[model samples]
Target: MGRRSDHSPDELRELLVLSGHALMGERGFAKFSAREAARRAGYSVGTIYNVFGGLDSYLIAINSRTFRQWGAWLEAALIDAPSDRAGRIEALVRAYFGFAQNNQNVWMAIYDHRIDRSIEIASEDDAAREGLTSIVDREVASTLGLNDNDARRLVRSLIATVHGHCALWLTGSYALLEEKDPAGQAVDRVLEILTHHLTPSES
Candidate 1:
């Protein structure tokens, strides 16, 4: 039986999200069940729709939480990283691989859950994404001496470049291709781009 008044509205919202996150981590997106998540939280499935609008919004909330966690993982990785361009970038890439591998289910859920473009997620929910982007943008800007806007613009493709390598590695596609040192390849490719971006005087 589900509890009726054990938690406040805010607490219920948080509990549901935590419950859903754990389920996503356990089942990934393909097998995740909203009913199961609510059941774990000692609530009815209708409570999820009532509190979060629908399954998609609840997932957006979960993914936003994941973004914050990923950002923190990156920060932790930098704690022992060398204070240099290549080293910092390498640390970021390795952290990306480590986090995604260690938490593949939840990590993949971040990409697997889809929503419409026009739907509005609250600003606080997006703050996590902004923090993750800020970390990458800062590193890229520092390495290449680019302004904030330019660095942010470039960070998109730069992230994709590394993500392609990491994703392939995770799914074992790299092994199928017999690719060696994919992480090293991604790091070197990034460094090559940074080196090529030198100003006329430096070049």
Candidate 2:
């Protein structure tokens, strides 16, 4: 960043998000600092507070960006996924594991950062964060031939199943369980859940 004055307001906001996102990637939530983010974006700490209102708001923006990036990564991973529904779900599960393994710091920060209760999440940022779930909800609806409400309900349950497996893998708890191929297990669990709703021919 040559001069903070060189960037317009929108540019500055983008820079702030990018800087904070990068910082979270490198140092994770515990070590994250708005001061460092401002320094990286070539601005004073006061400038960040003035622009964003507070650290919680700033963190939400950064984490929302992370969610978008994660969604992109998942989409890219599915590019060569098999044509069959089960295969595509398998690809999604594997990609979920792959992202967490590859981007440990930033991935964990998505869960680790907690906003102050008083700070309401901005609508745009909340929507960005929800995008990941939307993808899965759509897929679930298509897979089960269900309506939007049913799909949303089922997606939440299946996501919890997959997320648990991913969390176990991340925390090295898989070793304790003597498990192999946790991603495969996640795929299996997802399919099992769908099977409960499927007719024999559909299954």
Candidate 3:
């Protein structure tokens, strides 16, 4: 007879999610494996699908959880930061850098993940993906005195620039920046430009 399943579906699912998180946090998405996740969770490879449908589905769930956790970290970072707009934006940038450095594997997994075009992304998953951006969007709107659309556009631009710079740091392109600390310098320069451009001028 087959070995009996010891855990309920909910318990098993939770176990698999945690195991997947830890595994991906070490190996990153490129080398991730549902089989490895199941093995680590003390379940058979097939049992993972019995819970999550497939590897992609399982990863989507994992990525969603990761984003929510990251949002919490960013939120915590902002709490004691200065109340001024530039200071807050600077805090946000520094928080991103810290998160990326501290959780390199999981942080990269967020961007490294690629979903099938035919797959329907759950609304919660999309919202989770936007968690960090929503924080930036709010501050950008208030600081720049921008309307919703303009603030959103500016947020996207800022994310692209920061992400690109961070990517260079991750890829060891330090020489590309004319500074000792490429990532910090990039963030500082961008924040400086944003503050200068957005500050109200005296008549």
Candidate that would win on TM-score: 1
Colliding pairs, model 3: none
Residue 163, model 2: Cα distance from true site in angstroms: 1.1
Clash count per candidate: 0, 0, 0
- The TM-score-based order of candidates, best leading, equals 1, 2, 3
Please give, for residues 9-114, the per-residue lDDT of candidate 1 as tens digits.
8899999999999999999999999999999998889999999998889999988889989999999999989997678989998888788889888888887877
Rate residue 4 of model 1 by lDDT.
57
TM of each candidate vs. truth: 0.91, 0.90, 0.86
Q: Tens-digit lDDT track for model 2 on 1-203?
A: 44657888889889899999899989988999898999988888988887798888888888888788888888888898898888889998899889888888888887888776887999999898789988887666766767767777888888889889888777777452777788888999888888887657788
Against the reference, the lDDT scores of all candidates come to 0.84, 0.84, 0.78
lDDT of 3 by residue, 123-182 (tens): 878899888788877766666756768778877888888887776776567555454565
Task: List candidate 3 stretches off by more than 4 Å.
Answer: 1-6, 173-179, 196-203
- Model 1: how far residue 51 lies from native, Å: 0.9
Q: Could you give me the TM-score of model 3 versus the true structure?
A: 0.86
